[model samples]
Target: MSLQPIDSTQRIQSLDVIRGFSLLGIFIVNMIAFHSPMYYYDPYSWWGDSINRPVYWWIDVFVQASFYPIFAMMFGAGLAIQYMRAEEKKAHFTSFASRRLAILLGIGLIHAFLIWSGDILITYAVAGFILIWMLKLSGKMLLILGFIIYFLPQSLLSGIMFFASMVDPTTVTYFSSVQDIESSVANYGSGSFADIFGQRVDDWTYANSPAGFISIIIAILPLMMIGAGVAKTKLFEKASDKKLLLSLSALIFLGLGIAIKTSPYWGEKNLAFVFTQDYVGGPLVAMGYMTLLLLIMTAPLSAKLLQPLAKTGRMALTNYLLQSIIGTIIFYNYGFGLYGEVTLMTGTLIALGIFVMQVIFSELWLSKFKQGPAERLWRKLSYSKK
Candidate 1:
């Protein structure tokens, strides 16, 4: 079947709203690296200063590792949505999805190598390719697989670290060396564009290694599958029907997630605990957030208030790249050279300001155009000659 574009009227407001909300959280977390060297971001060691410690702790407990899963799950939901649309039109799913992901991979490469090393687009694109095959799984199987894929690697690593640390008290290291930290700061903060570009290349290289690649796939792909399961179940579309189940899930998952995530504060920040907090608790909290958003969207009072966020979500691809562009310009040496100069609080405030502007821009832009600029480009490329 021929591919057709989804009209604005056909868009789901809740997905857009939740996606926009996730962007704010993502920026809040990413601002740390944008303004400083992330190689040594240990709160207990690098940020020993008491004043900023609390801020960092709050961000870690509430913001970090929470929203990425939400974004990933939403991506899966998007694939499922596209699949459903394709089925409705009697089109081939794999062909369209493969081309779409190919274009996304190109965009991700440009962003990762040229713009920022911390880009998640490459992971998303790679995971998207894998997600196409798992779309046929039942919701129960998808959820089970999501948990298994996400936790198995972390669990094994955590077990090894725990056992090793028990055998050798000094086996566990919490933060990077001071020399590495200083070098990172120098390269990112004051180095020439070439120097910074070289550093970015190194960072990307480390992140794209076989081990790193597998780790990311295991972490991300399962969430995407769960998201596909959510789409298949029509959970969001039929929110009212599953209100009780969603409410209970929100309570249980968020409670357990918060408990696991906060365990680091009570003890040492070892590899085992870190893995559990991020790999396990993170996705749980993200699901809780999703269900909570769905519940909120059911309320009539929230619809008007959420419209701007929905607009932002509708143009997420454009805004995501824009964040990288604007953030790098603000913090990199080639631009304002504010790297390593701003505190976490200041960085967060800046992120919030940028997000506000983006929301306004999104609302205005959507009024005139059918899709965000980048979204339009992606769709154009994906549907070309279809």
Candidate 2:
């Protein structure tokens, strides 16, 4: 007997729905970087106008750091699912996983360099390789390990920054330089493709600095572990029997997430508060969202309503890359040259427009095909006997 991929009947509708939902948030956040000098400017002051500030605040509290954690967790869940399938079939999990991640790395490199500087796929793929090694641990242990690894470094850094801010508030707000910002505006807005490529490298380098590995590990790996842990406990299989538990967990998580996320606003947008808000509160909100979506999915009516989103989620990778492609065309010099020109509100609206178009497109495309083109290619390469 040989291993085979899971069919549509075995797929989780709720998971798909959640994944589809996160794509919107991720695009919304990415749009800010796509059309602006996001890397060089301190966001708080850059979007400080009365009009943009409220838009920025809405993004900060509800959208910014909130969605990616959910996606990272889901990525781990996906790995765990494949691992369990491999084990069930007595196949070689490690080799298959390695090849799979390698392909993802290749795709990520192209996206990060040739397409967009703000790509998360490269980081995710690299961290996934690390996660594949630690899959042998028990689920509860994985969860505990994830919590400790994430909390310790994040809290310590937040504390250190808070202390430094006490000495001088500017210490935490000095990531910008006039030349970098001006250069970004120029290159992305009106330069040739070669010029834009040069700027893309600079932007990617700044975001993925070599020294930030530990930070990236804590940021990405922990959520992934927690997700794998959840999968091990068979939460998806057994969640149906625990609707009440899910309900309570959703409320508590959402409440705490919201309260903590408001730290920058109610407490003050100091480095400490900002760190706490993004690093600590963001994941909490992501958890809340996952649970809440799961709970809603339990309802027959709600599940039916969210079926379209599930389709979107099923084609996640295709849509993600498409977002970058479309975003660049709309804003980059090669397209409309609207880069570094749109307001926050306008950029956000564009993101929404893109998502809406994707939803319609996914629905139409999946009506006949089993998956997105990118997913088909990934599966073909991974499962091909060649």
Candidate 3:
């Protein structure tokens, strides 16, 4: 049973389109951290002036915690596709996937330490190693397991924190002091390259600490498993057949997601609310987005209009790294040194401008190359017979 090698021609347009779509949302979210010290605490307290407060509020409700789940799901779906192909070809799936993830981990390390402290690739690559073992589970089991893994730790942690906060209000503080905020502004906004690099190292260490690593693994592995389940069920492939289910899912998930995610604004941004919004509402909304896109892809006119997004999705790796490079240069001390200077609205506009440029660049690049440069390198290294 020999399977044909997957080529660009065999690529699924909807998957690419969704990936591309997620890129824009991700950039919008990441830009907040890129240009400010928002990653250290709630930006609303320190940086959200009156003019940009509403913008920050809207992004918190609608954009934050949404796109990353979609990206994780797609990654799982991709791995499942690879497994199926390997099975058909009787190839060494585990060995090949291990090699692939290892190379990805190497790339992530450089990206994380040298380029950006907020890198997600390292987490993805590490979680992917565990995902390979769970690829054999049934879709139903995978979904159940994914939900359990996603909710359990966060729920427990949030519950404990909530109770502690009730007993001791000081326990729940997430915002840095004004002094710390001012120091961050000085260090990142006007400091030299060495100063910025030191801060980046410290940030990376905290984010990739033992507990942080464990939490990321718990959160991400399930999404990958659910993605594998989606591929196995061919949910996207038979979209019309599952119209009723998809439609219902979209309505229910989107409605509930909006409700849960916006609850923080109405009340305090407590640990419980944050967990629910990120772990539960985030994935639900991401599912709704996936279903909505699938429905839209069925229409010829809509699909044609979305071709640019598909092209962008195909080059996701290149664009992702490009975003990090361009973002740091633009906002960090090394380049324009605009950190903590841009407002939320201005940052949002910058993200949109970058995305538009990326879309055009993606189309032009894909016209001349079968794969993005990074993607080509990844494949070559993964398959090299060293």
On TM-score, the leading prediction is 2
Writing each residue's lDDT as its tens digit, candidate 1 over 1-386 gives: 76778898888888999899999999998888788777555655666587678888888777889999999999999998888888888888998899999999999999988888888988999999999988878766777787787778767877787788789847775766577567667877889989888888887876679998887887889889888888878887899788899899999989988987887787668766776777777877888899999988888788778999999999999999999999999988888988889877889899999999999999999999999999999999988564
Better of 2 and 3 by lDDT: 2
User: What TM-score would every model get versus the actual structure?
Assistant: 0.96, 0.97, 0.94
Ranking by lDDT: 2, 1, 3
Query: For candidate 2, lDDT tens digit of each residue in 306-334?
Result: 99999999999999999999999998899
For candidate 3, give the lDDT: 0.83
lDDT by candidate, in order shown = 0.85, 0.88, 0.83
Q: What is the lDDT of residue 261 in candidate 2?
A: 95
- Candidates 1 and 2 compared: the better one by lDDT is 2
TM-score of 1: 0.96
Clashes of 2: 0
- Candidate 1: which stretches are off by over 4 Å? none
RMSD of 1: 1.6
Encode model 3's per-residue lDDT on 1-386: one tens digit a residue.
Answer: 32334688777788899999999989999998888776567655655578988998888888889999999999988888888778777877888889899999999989887888889898899889999888888777877888787767767776787688789867766666566557667877898878888878877876778987887888889888888888877886888777788788889889988887887777677665676777777878888888889888877798899999999999998999999999989988878999988788999999999999999999999899888999989988887453
Ten contiguous residues with the weakest lDDT in model 3: 1-10
TM-score of candidate 3 against the unseen true structure: 0.94
